[model samples]
Target: MKKFTVLELLSLELKEHNDLDLKCIAGRKGLARKIEVPNVNRPGLALSGFFESFAYNRIQIFGRGEHAYLKKLEKEKKSENIKKIFTFDIPCAIFTHNLMPTKDFLDAAEEAGCAVLQTSLPSANFTARILRVLNDIFAAREVVHGVLIEVFGIGVLLTGESGVGKSETALELIERGHRLVADDAVEIRCVGGNYLMGMGANKMLGHHMEIRGLGIINITHLFGVGSIRDEKRIELVVNLEIWDSNKQYDRLGAQKKTKEILGVRLPCVDIPIKPGRNIPILIETAAMNERLKQLGVHSSREFNEQVMRWLESENVRNIYFHNNSI
Candidate 1:
């Protein structure tokens, strides 16, 4: 079930009272009810008496002073304004600081269809705590259009415009034994110490990908159970673009690329796609290369070093031969 937040439950308007716990009591709200706050500590104020004036349809009481004062206000038969304000159609009243509603307050609440509850926490503290909890629980959930797949045990998130062949490339990767995490729309969240995790949306879960002219085909169904993944930790990002012949590409692999999500940095690679270039093979190679780096092996750098050493050795030999001939 979806989570509910405390901020989502609070009443629209609030009236401050002397009891600090009263703020905590304000946190208790229902979709159908209102809350009544009594000014027990400050009986001298005319505005304080106005609470008994509203419709007490649903009320809950907390705190002993509020309980006792409500009875006194009822016995004295407060003014019409006070009656209108206090006689609210409230559903529940929460008592803070372990204060219990008086018998008179209970009787009035019962007659008015109000419920009362008590709380031990200070009002301000409770409200603050509940607000934070609600913020996390009630945050909106939406689908982010992107492709996410697990490559070489590293979660890679691919982002680009529509019809960029993201799904097709992902399908190829799946066929090559890489796991498909999500297609079309991936829902990503930051969890476990700032690491981004991704999963398929409920509607798109376990669904096959669609490539232009290729029609719809399921990855797991076509490639067996080894092809699909339930979830994956996003560790890298790959952005695909239409190949430009005039643009210079990084042939030396010296350029370090990364992307930031939710304040966490992820390794990134930009692969330009065009005719005759196997994008899937390149992606696989990139993934494997990343694994090698993690395991302390750098193929490109090592190969470059080997070539440099060979050139140096040949230069030394040529100089010796020239000296001997001279």
Candidate 2:
């Protein structure tokens, strides 16, 4: 239950949604209004005096059709419907395509303490873009310390203790042409209750990484833009740790381990760190294997089944040979 104020929504730093061009036209007093829902309402039926199930909590959008109806009602001296529409505790009113509400409508909004917003984008475009922004704002989020990278189109998160060399392995992956999503602190958000999206906690330091001895280096500047990505959907979680000679590790990939974040279970793999071992290549293979699993091809399970079938055939062959000789 994240509360996003109308003022903060206005000053969103999303670069892709610059076309919204939103500004407060009137009723600045209601800028503190709370926007709870991620969706917006057209209010066409409500403006026509049909108030059944009106979503009062959502931001009301006045598109081209709604704007025309408002102007017609103003001209016909029918201000009762306009007054009725503002009776609810609406968060704000937005007019798209630079369409301005009539004097009567604006006055109704002002009297009811509703913020009126204007956007230069067309009605459909504005509606689509604003919905996307609100969806991200309302998504469930949590921060984790890790390095996220995209290898062979799969998002892999490398996480471990303080001196586990996650950043160093990420640097090697970038050198191999993999894209780096985030370093150090990764902000993860659960999108649509199904997926986890990971990105850098700070946009300013997104492309920068810190190695133990070398300090900080910029991946984008060093490897060009192709080696960096803004964010990625984390599909696998690989935990790296120091090699323990006394402990036995899973060699057949039969042990299925998962780490849950925001209620989504991500496949987990533990890689032991030892001198002379290629961790970056192991991570890349893990990513590719995950992609194959998603396509309904489980190499480990298939191998296990093949081995079982071979043993059964060998037993049958030995029994037949003994019976024929007898």
Candidate 3:
């Protein structure tokens, strides 16, 4: 993880609901201060003259209550605790609901070189949004060589050796009304330690494909905007390899296989590629099958169980007939 500074947070180009709507109010020099943690602390206790377990490293959030309390304190000319709170190495202070801190607080923050930011969003909403943004920034991530596509509403990652027709198959899938998440290098991150989310490594190069003979092509322009997605939760992985005649493949599908990335395991399938084999169709079917598995419909296991039941019934009838005849 690289250094995430307060300036970077301010410069984030989030839109609409996810936007923080933040602007610097004071201490511009401390914009380069590193935000060490993803959490925020409300300095109500510390503002009330108690600093026994004050979390000074976290970004301090001054909501309406904290702001009003500061007003009350300033009315009585009590500036000791306000000055004392800034004595520690705090990352920054954010006043939510467009609330502005008093002059004493701002002066104390400026003197301590602590950045002060203001947002129009209420305290709860801003807290939720910032926490989500921070969690994504600090999540475990990995980059793998593959094409990520969304087939039948399932996120599928295509992985194989170079020249395995991954991009081509993805192109076909896109033509078939499926959406492409990324091409070539897919950046995968483990979100919430339960699911994997994948997207393009670079946003500027989004929805672009580099074919062997086609050079570079834009999927959004060629297929339209509906064919491209910014990101998706990776639900399945398909490994396409050259068809090996000598290699035994899992025809029954009873043996489940998975691939681990960033501490999260995803359902995996190995599709053997050969001349005249429709790789895109195979991948699409794999995606649908994965969806079925998620719905508790294990086709292979159910088929195997049914076969065992039939065999047991045939053996029981045979033994009874033999005993009666004897």
Per-residue alpha-carbon lDDT of model 3 for 53-89, expressed as tens digits?
Answer: 9999888999999999999999999999999988898
Expressed as tens digits, the lDDT of each residue in 1-326 for candidate 2 is 88888998888876765447899999888899999899999899998889999998999999899999999998899999889988898999999989989999999989988899999999889888988788788999999999999999999999999889999999999999999999999999998899999999999776999999999998989999999999899999999999999989999998999999999999999999999999999999999999999999999999999999999999999999999999
What Cα-based lDDT does every candidate model obtain?
0.63, 0.92, 0.92
> lDDT by residue for model 1 over 165-205, one digit each (tens)?
89988987887788888888887765533677788876544
Clashes of each: 40, 0, 0
Provide C-alpha RMSD values for all models, in order.
Answer: 11.3, 1.9, 1.2
Model 3 spans with C-alpha error above 4 angstroms: none
Reference-based TM-score of each model? 0.54, 0.93, 0.97
Runs in model 2 with CA error above 4 Å? none
Give the least accurate 10-residue stretch of model 3, judged by summed lDDT. Answer: 132-141
Q: Which regions of candidate 1 are displaced past 4 Å?
A: 1-144, 192-194, 201-206, 214-224, 322-326
